[model samples]
Structure formats: C-alpha cells, structure tokens
Target chain A: MNSFTPDRTSFEARLHKIGDERYHDKHPFHHLLHSGGCTPDQVRAWVINRYYYQSRIPMKDAAFLSRVTDPALRRSWRRRIEDHDGTEDGTGGIHRWLRLAEGVGLDPDYVSSARGVLPATRFAVDAYVRFVRDEPMLPAVASSLTELFAPKIHKDRIAGLLEHYEFANSDTISYFQHRLSEAPKDVAFGLEWVLDHAVTKADQDAAANALIFKTEVLWAQLDALYSAYVSPARIPPGAWQPGEGLLQ
Target chain B: MNSFTPDRTSFEARLHKIGDERYHDKHPFHHLLHSGGCTPDQVRAWVINRYYYQSRIPMKDAAFLSRVTDPALRRSWRRRIEDHDGTEDGTGGIHRWLRLAEGVGLDPDYVSSARGVLPATRFAVDAYVRFVRDEPMLPAVASSLTELFAPKIHKDRIAGLLEHYEFANSDTISYFQHRLSEAPKDVAFGLEWVLDHAVTKADQDAAANALIFKTEVLWAQLDALYSAYVSPARIPPGAWQPGEGLLQ
Candidate 1:
C-alpha cells in the first residue's frame, strides 16, 4: 500500500529486479546443485520435482494464451506452448525435462503424471495459474519475467547437473539445452508485452508484484525439496522418497 | 511400496510416531508460535495467515460431507461445520479467530475475507480441500487427524499467546480456547471412525496416507510462511508483506 511509484523505467527493469532479488537463481540448492555439492539423490529429486514445474510452464502459458484475443499476441505466446509441449509427441520442453528425469534415473511417466511431485511444488505451480485467472492481465504477463533469469540458471543447472551427476546423459538434458535458446526469446517477447502495456505507476507496481509471485512459485518448490530430501524427516504422502527403492 | 503389513497396534503407533517426528508440532515456528517465543508482529502474521486455514476447514469438510450419503456420518461431520460457521452471526470458530486477529492488530474484516493472507497459505489449504473432494470418504475423515493434535497445541497456543504477547486479550484467544475443547472431541470421533473402518492393510495404509496428507498441508503452510516471511526473498504477490499495509 506504499503508493510509492517509479516513473517509466521500462517496467521490465522492475520485473527484472524482482528476479534479481527473489529468483531461484540465488537459491542455495542451485549452487550446491551446480557445483556438484548435492547428493545424487538430491540431484534426482531436483530433476524429478522440477519436471512437474517444467511440464506446467507450457500449460500455464497455454492458459494465459487462451485468455488473449489478439491473434498476434496469441501467436507470440504460443511459442511457449510449443517449447514445452513440442510439435507432436515426445519432444518439447516437457520431453527434454523427461530426459532430465530419465538421465537422473526417474520414470518419465511418473514425472508427467506428477504423482510424486512435492506438495509445495504442486501448490506453487497451481498458484501461478490461479494468479493469472484471479488478477489483471498485465500482472499475469509480468509474472513470466522469472523467465528473465531462467537462461542463466538453466545453463548453470545443465552444466552442473552433467558435471556432478554420473547417471545423467546429455539426451536427458535436452530440456535445459533447449531452454537456453527458447527462454530468452520468450522472456524478450513477454517483457516487451509487459513494458508496452504497463504505463502507470500502478502498472509498474503490478509488474513488480507479478514477478514476486513467480519467484515464490519457484522458491516454494525448493523449500519443499530441502525440507523433504535434505534437512527433513517427512516427505509427505505420495511424494517421491529418495530412499524408496533399490534404485537409490 | 513398503508392503510390510503392520498390525493395527504397530500401524497406529508408528503413525503417531510420525506425528511426533514429521508433524508441524516439530516445526520451529509452530513451537515459537504456540510457546509464545514469536514477536507480536510474528504472532499477528500467524493469526492472519492461520485464519485462512481455520475458515476453510469447515467448508472443505462440508464439500466432502455433501458427497457422503451416510446419515450417521453426515451427522458426525456436521459438527465441524457448526464448529466453524457457528449457529448465528459472530459465533463459532471464525468469529473467535477474528478476535485473535484483532488481538494482533489486524482488522476483522480483512481476516475473515483472507485479504492479507499469503498466497502459499491459500494454495496449501485449497489443495487439502481438493484432496478431500477428490478422494474417498475414509481419507477425507483421515485428513482430520491434525485436529487430534490441535487441541493440545491450541491449549499451549492460547495460554502462551495470551501470557507472552503484548497485544493479546482473553477475548482474542477465544478461538483457540474453543478449539482446545472442541478438537479433541472431534478428533477422537474421527480416529475411532477410521480405525474401525480401515480393516484391510491397504485401507490402513491409506488412512496413514491421509494423515500424512494433512500433516503436509499444515507443514506446507508453514513452509510457505518460512520462505515468504522467514526468508523474505520469496514473498509472493497478493500476500501480506511486512512494513507494508496488509492489502494487495
């Protein structure tokens, strides 16, 4: 309620700042993960749980796209859908995430159904869709700005995951590799859309708020992981227990 | 899956042990919370966020209740609805929770509408409701095991919050006071219902799973708080932010 406003800073800058401060790029696990500091079980848990997030991104964008009327806007956002769902079948970002899952020794089917996803992960992703459905369109678009920092973390993750984890294969990392190119394009277009529309101070604030929402969505996912796999006791029912099988 | 079937004695004991271990009873915040170790600001945040959880409990039970045709069961479950919504205006658990909110300096109007609650709190609770609505009657009843633990915590919370916090009053602690008496009765009934009905190993496992689900629901709510308020970097949009007014 601090009506303090920033004047015409491209709106994107505010969104980017939100990411600079809040994005999972700075999450502890990411460093431990990228630097090969996490346990193998931890690495698999990240890939498996994150597969739920990765699979949802396209659906989230699709939901966002379905709300827009302009063919142009719809077309621009549709790339996000393509990037995840892929052209036909076992291909898109989801497929690549599946590869990550497989490389990390998870079942693609289990990841896709999201049967074993962390509860916090499920709620956070669902929260994004609800935010779009509940709030204004501009903020909804602004929330995607987490993509603003996705490329870097995704790159760090791909390299770190590959270098640190022996079970992982490059084919399974297809999703991260694809994201290196796709996220920038998506973030650029989404940024342009948000910047073009968020004219007033409220708009900038809204954009800033949206990125905060996206950041929470990612952060909560990690909190669930840390609590469940690392510093934790219960992983909740139906969540993947790292020590559940001979695979571990 | 761990197919090692346990007897009713071992199963119930092991399940309760999980409660002792994995339950939010073990969460530091909850301990700080019920033990009155939290700041007044922290207490206000707790009540404001928690009112959302308490307010929805009855509605979720109602939703599940509607799906059940057993009149005896309906008669039993109906008590929860009455416990929350109450017999008349400003009666029941919610009104009392408003007192708790008021005790902590939050507006009653805001508390009831959940205007300042964290998005993570909302989603975690909503997921619990969805779980009940989607699951069978047994699990629905089983999810209420958190209530069994609540009465003890409620006592500690009411006494500790009133005794320790500067802002609380006897009237404000009325919510937990009532819950202290009401929860044990309700939880006892729920435990008996589940224990008697879950005759098979799968049924017992599921009942255990349901309790685990409830534990996660509560735990995830706190995780959301720890990430958002405790960590601050992950605070989502449309959630209560400190040093700012409680509106989005």
Candidate 2:
C-alpha cells in the first residue's frame, strides 16, 4: 500500500476521478431519461423512485449534524436540512421534487407517501444515510463529495429535460435549478474539509472509497430502475407499477 | 394527540404488537425458507445476503458505543461488539456467520468480502446502523427492542434449518444458538431502559416507532430477497446470483 499522501491538487484529482468514473450521471438510465428516450411511464417511475432519494437527503444531513460537535460545522450543515426541508412552508428540494412528480403527471401525495417506490431505491438511499451516520468523520464527509459532481448533472438534466420532455419547465425542474446554485457551495466546503482532514494515505484511500460508495448508492438506484422498468421489465413486487399513480 | 403515556404493561404490549404485526419471521419468504421450501440456491442467496447484516452488527454497536458517554452504558454496550467481533481471532458472531456461509457451501472469503450481497440487504442493514448511531438516545435504544423478538426467531430458525437443510448442524447453527442466550440479556436491559426513559407520551411513541422502523428494516430485506429470488424474480442489478458465489 502506498504510504505517501498526495498533495492537495493530486488529492482533488483523485476525488474527481472517482466521480468521473463512478457517479450515477453515467448510469444508462440517466442517459435514457435525459435524452428523450424514456416513455412517460418510465419518467413517472423515475420521479417516484427518485423521490425516495430526495426526501432522505435532509434526514441524512440531520443525522450527520447530530453527530457533529463543532459548532461551525453544525451551523454550516444545518443549511442543508433547511435547503431540502424548506424554511417555513413546505418549500424545499423535497417539495420541488414533489412538483416534478406533479409535472410528470404523478400525484404529489402518492409521490410523497413513498409507498410506491422500488425496494431497491429505498435500500440504496437508506444506505447513503447510514454511511453518513456511521462512517468515521473523514469518510463520512468524503461521501458528500458526490456533490462535487452534482452541478454538472443538474445542469445537463435541466437542459436535457427541457429540450426533450414536455413536462420539463422552470417550475417543475426548479429542484435541479435550485440545486445548481446550492450544490457547489456544499461541495466546495466538503471537498476542502475532506482534503484537509485526510492527511494520511489510508485516510485518503478511505475518502476516495467513500465517494465511490456514494456513487454506488446512486448508481445502484438507477440500476434498480433500469432493471425493473427498462427492457424485459421485471418490476419488483409492490414497487410502483407504471400507470398506477398517475395524476388525474 | 394522546398526552398520557401508557403504563409499562401497555407499553410492553404495544412493543410486542409491533413485532407480531411486522417481524420478518412472519414474512412469506421466512415461511418458505424455514419450512424447507427453498431450493439450495435460494438458501445460498439468503446466506450471502444475511451475512451483510450479521457482519455489520459490531460496527453498528461500536457506532452506538462511540456516541455513548456513560461508562455503565458503554460497559453494557461494549459486550455487543465483543459478542459479534470477538475479543480475539477465530471468534465472534461474524466469524460464526461465515462458518454458516461455509456450511451452506459458500466461499467464506466471498461471504466476508460482501461483494455479492443484495444491495437491498446492505441498505436495510445500514439503515439500522444509522438509526442506532444518530437517533436520539431513547429511540436509538428502543430500536434494539427488536431483540426482544429475536430469540423466538432464532429458536425457529435453528429447529427449521436442522429439520430441513442438510447443511444444518450443531456447529453451523451455533451463531443463532449463541444469540438465543445473548439477545435476551441485551433486550431485557434495552426494554427496561426504554421503559424507564420514555417518560413522556411522545417519547413512548417515538420509541415504539423506532422499534417499528427496525422491524421494517428486517422485513424489507426479506422482501427484497423474496422479490428477487422467488416468483417472477427481478433481482436488482448486480445482486448475488445463485450458482455464482458458492464454494467450489
């Protein structure tokens, strides 16, 4: 095992490599979804399933916040919960996701209930939360580095969805639009924190692996979606069946 | 909202009801597996998937221990990690779980590596760890109340496997056997602690729900298994496929 830790730029490159190679944006389902390839049913399925991930983000952040002792860290992390959960009225990333659900012709209530989400989706998202909660401080912080790769995906998604699907609009896609601004700040802070703390080679390797793990958490969710909804569909029992929860 | 906390007997009954209503032992997959209805491949799948949960027990306990400030609580909780991780090599629940993996004709290394386990299993098990690590002390402690229900399942599992599967032996089944003795002490303490601390109605409800959430974690894993391995199988992409990871 290499015992030498790379300098900051090299370390940052290694982190980017993980995202470039492993981030879920590269998943085939995203390719299909973004490029006008998915049917309305498939889009609905994605919206319903992806909602599970969106809803859990704040909870995951809250779990992280609960463990943090540093007042400044807690204060910084607290904004994440607010961003997703909203300040007063229901108006955050989660609410925006629900709007996307509605725009996709799904019932907002049904989407929010999350009862119809794929079991695999639930598992993958929950795994992300657990990783944040239980891993050592460095790796836990590193896992959030997936945000480093998020802005581009959000940009691509906003562009591709608007260009491809009729449901794509400023109001409906506001979640991604908002995230474009929100994610970079989070990622910048997170990436710096990880780089600063991961002084040892072992710690660096762990942080890299944690980023990879986060990517898997994301990639796995898409894999589940593709397997169940794409060709030769084998939607797992009790997962949202296409045409089941469409908006009236 | 009910402002009155139920008396201890009522609270205890409520906890049992959550188990009775939601435990994985009641899941159809368990009925099949316990009754020898599963094929060998199905059994192998169970072993590989369930191992993820078994291996994480110590890590979960350690996360709990790290958060714990009380020496007495830490002293009591530390035993759980030891029980699973062992004080020395060639011991602990994780090692025994691998032995069972071996008993069922799987490569212990593959099992330990956990590369082939279902993503769903990883998620559910990780969620349990996160719940323990991050939730408020009362609810976090209450989640372990599922242990109160574990002994019976262990009893059932041991008898059923012995009666049904040729792999079943005194040695292979010893993990569950050991848990039978170990869990009761843990649960008795956990249940009492929960009862003692859950003084408010809201606390009692959160505690009850935490236990219920845990039962879902256990139940969801079996659901993923049954969905993937049972009828009209839709194994999430990259989960263990039977005949792939077995001992040669």
Best by TM-score: 2
RMSD of each: 18.9, 19.1
Expressed as tens digits, the lDDT of each residue in B1-248 for candidate 1 is: 24566666776786687688767877878877766677666766777788878777765765665455333454466567667766566677877877777667776776666777888888899899778767887888888887767766766776777777776677877777787778888988988888777777888879889899889989988888777666554667777766443423
lDDT of 1 by residue, A1-248 (tens): 13465545645566667778899888887778889888868877887788767666654664564345333454456567556656555556766776666676666666666677788888898888668645789988988888888888877887787787786567867777887898899888888887788777777777888889789988998888888888764678888877542123
Stretches of model 2 off by over 4 angstroms after superposition:
A1-3, B1-248
- Which ranges in model 1 have alpha carbons more than 4 Å from their true place? A1-5, A243-248, B1-248
How well does candidate 1 match the true structure in TM-score terms? 0.49
| DockQ (Cα-based) for each candidate | 0.01, 0.01
Error of 2 at B75 (Å): 35
After aligning candidate 2 to the native by TM-score, how far in Å is the CA of A228 from where it should be? Answer: 0.7
> Which interface RMSD does candidate 2 score?
15.6
- TM-score of chain A in every predicted structure: 0.91, 0.97
